[model samples]
Target: MKLTIQRHQKGKSYEETFDVASLKVTTLLAALYEIKAKMDESLTFDAGCRSGVCGACALRVNGRETLACSYTPHDGDRIEPLNYHPVQRDLKVDKEKPQETLKRVLPTTIQNPKSKIQNPPLSSEDEAKFRVQTDCILCDSCYSACPVLAVNPDFLGPFALTRAWRYHTDPRYIEEVPNDSIQHLTSKIQNPVLLDTVQQNGIWDCTLCGECTAVCPQQIDPKSDIMQLRGESLKAGYSDPTLSTPSFGTPDFGGGFGFDPNAGF
Candidate 1:
């Protein structure tokens, strides 16, 4: 096996590789441990709750973001820290910023929590709307999977807004959602730094293609989350921020590689 990473050893980055033969490392974490214990002790990566509970071991495998705890290693696989965030050392990313975003979204309950509805009475119609949204683990996989984060670093990405959906969809929320909750959730949608983010760019950039959902180990559907934001924003009649973007500005026109349902060029 040969693994390469954007190594930030001491204070710099260089693509570093390691070779292994006669080997059988399962998870990416195990492979890194094997390399450290036997090959290069200085090599670094991050992992905890190897059962996939904690998202500490996130990395990019074959160019897609994934948690190393759940991802098995492949020979000649190019493994590095997440494509978006700075590599703390090897595969470990600084989750603090994303963590702060989670806190800001306030995606949970505290006082006077709504009683759990036994056989909750959501019409099958609403159930269909809410069911796919309750399964988020806050793994930030969508955050990493997003090309918005790759370039427009300040973009809120998918996790925060998706997380907002987790609570908003709760039938037991007890009271109306607070207006203060999202006063600024999309205010930064137009920040120049994040201008290139998806149509959910503020809440419209998401194609809802389920790429984030497909890669998530925890079954969190980031596409669903972004869609909820779009519906809510439109219901409130807020002008969609991306609509102001030049008709030609959409990546689909050219220059940027927006998702292509039709391709083969």
Candidate 2:
């Protein structure tokens, strides 16, 4: 079978084709290994825990983000590095830059006094709110598939925003303190700093195109997480900055068909 791979070296990009003996159950990662072992020793890609748990082998196969360790290769499959990330070499992208966005927006620690007493109690019902988001492996698949990043590089991509929602909605962070308390526990209000951080170039900026959710190997829906974040932001008194801009250019004539634009009419 013929497999074409997009490669980059010394700041130059090119494509190379290799012929491999295909088996019925051979995965794309195995095919890459075969090519590297016999065909070209210089072939480069990332792989670890080839069982698809490590998420290190994620790349674009036929212009779609997928785990190379699990995806089967076809006769003319084209493999390339993930988009919206700096390629370190052939099929290996620099994820450090995109991963840093998590630190910039999410709270570093849960500030619940109850955690000091005991591991803050979490009910199954509360856990259901953000449980799916915990499956994120820090893979750049959603980041590569996000259309928002194409327009605004500063916009916090899907994974980061999903994590933000996870931390924001945690019951431990939202518990309120009792007025007369012997334990001296303080109010565990949600982090205001996080709410402020996501207001700009963040949740409001995402187009919610669902592409991020489509390509996720974990089936984590970042699009839905982002929508929930918007609701949380609204409850926290943050309005969409995009809505503040005038949609129509008609003059406001007091009460005659002139409604307040800031009211979101």
Candidate 3:
């Protein structure tokens, strides 16, 4: 099959079409591998956990970021590297910094004071609720789907923020520990929007566009999580700089984003 890859090298961006299906399974990475092994030995890309567990293989498929190893090849799919990260070669980009940003944001779990479930027990219902979030393999599809990270470098990507929410939302993490070091850290340093910090570095910036939700193979809805995060922020008295009248349905944090409380979707 014929493949067109968006290539970047030496500060230039261009596309290179190659005939690789003369060889492999047409898996996106396999096709690229064929081209690299048979045609251009110098071609470069990064991949690991070919099953999609590792986000290392992330790339842009027709202008959207997706993990190359996990993406099945389509006849005319245009393959490019991920945006918002430095391209290291033909289909590889550096994702560490963004992932690190999430770490800086205190991405972890915290138990709610009212949670009935205990950490060790891990009730079936609560487990089901968080199962999808736990399935995230760091494929970075959510990061690719995030609109805020597209324009605002300061806006931490979904994986990081979502992880933080997982910790805070997990009844286990928050149990009996009214607050801990992480809470303090989320309150002070990393201070992500979803991590219950006072500043605007977290959820307030999320557009909740559902792109992250759509691209997630594991079915985690970072968009919904982000919206829930907004509610958490509001209850915490986090003010929306963009909101004026403070009225209901006012979209107080209208940084170009969504939903009245009852309309949570």
lDDT of each: 0.64, 0.82, 0.68
Give the CA lDDT, 0 to 100, for residue 181 in model 1.
38
Task: Give the runs in model 3 whose Cα sits over 4 Å from its true position.
Answer: 107-119, 175-194, 245-265
Best by TM-score: 2
Candidate 2: lDDT of 250? 57
Q: What would the per-residue lDDT of candidate 1 be over residues 1-265, giving only the tens digit for each residue?
A: 7877667877877887887665568887888888889888988777778878777777778878787778877778888776566667766677778666655455333433344544446667766665655566566777777766655666666777675665555544423234553434543221211221223434565556577777787776777677766666554445566555445323464534453436555
Error of 3 at 125 (Å): 3.0
* Candidate 2 lDDT tens digits, 1-265: 8999999989899999987855333899999888888878888899999997889999999999999999998989999999889988899888988899999765655456546654567889999988888888887899999988888998889999988888877766633322434113222336555666787899888888999999999999999988987886676666887666544545564554445656764
CA lDDT of 151 in candidate 1? 56
User: How good is model 1 by TM-score?
Assistant: 0.71
RMSD of 1: 8.7
Better model by TM-score, 1 or 2? 2
Lowest lDDT 10-residue stretch of candidate 3: 185-194
Angstrom error of the Cα, residue 93, model 1: value is 1.7
Candidate 3's displacement at residue 77, Å, is: 2.3
Please report the candidate that would top lDDT against the real structure. Answer: 2
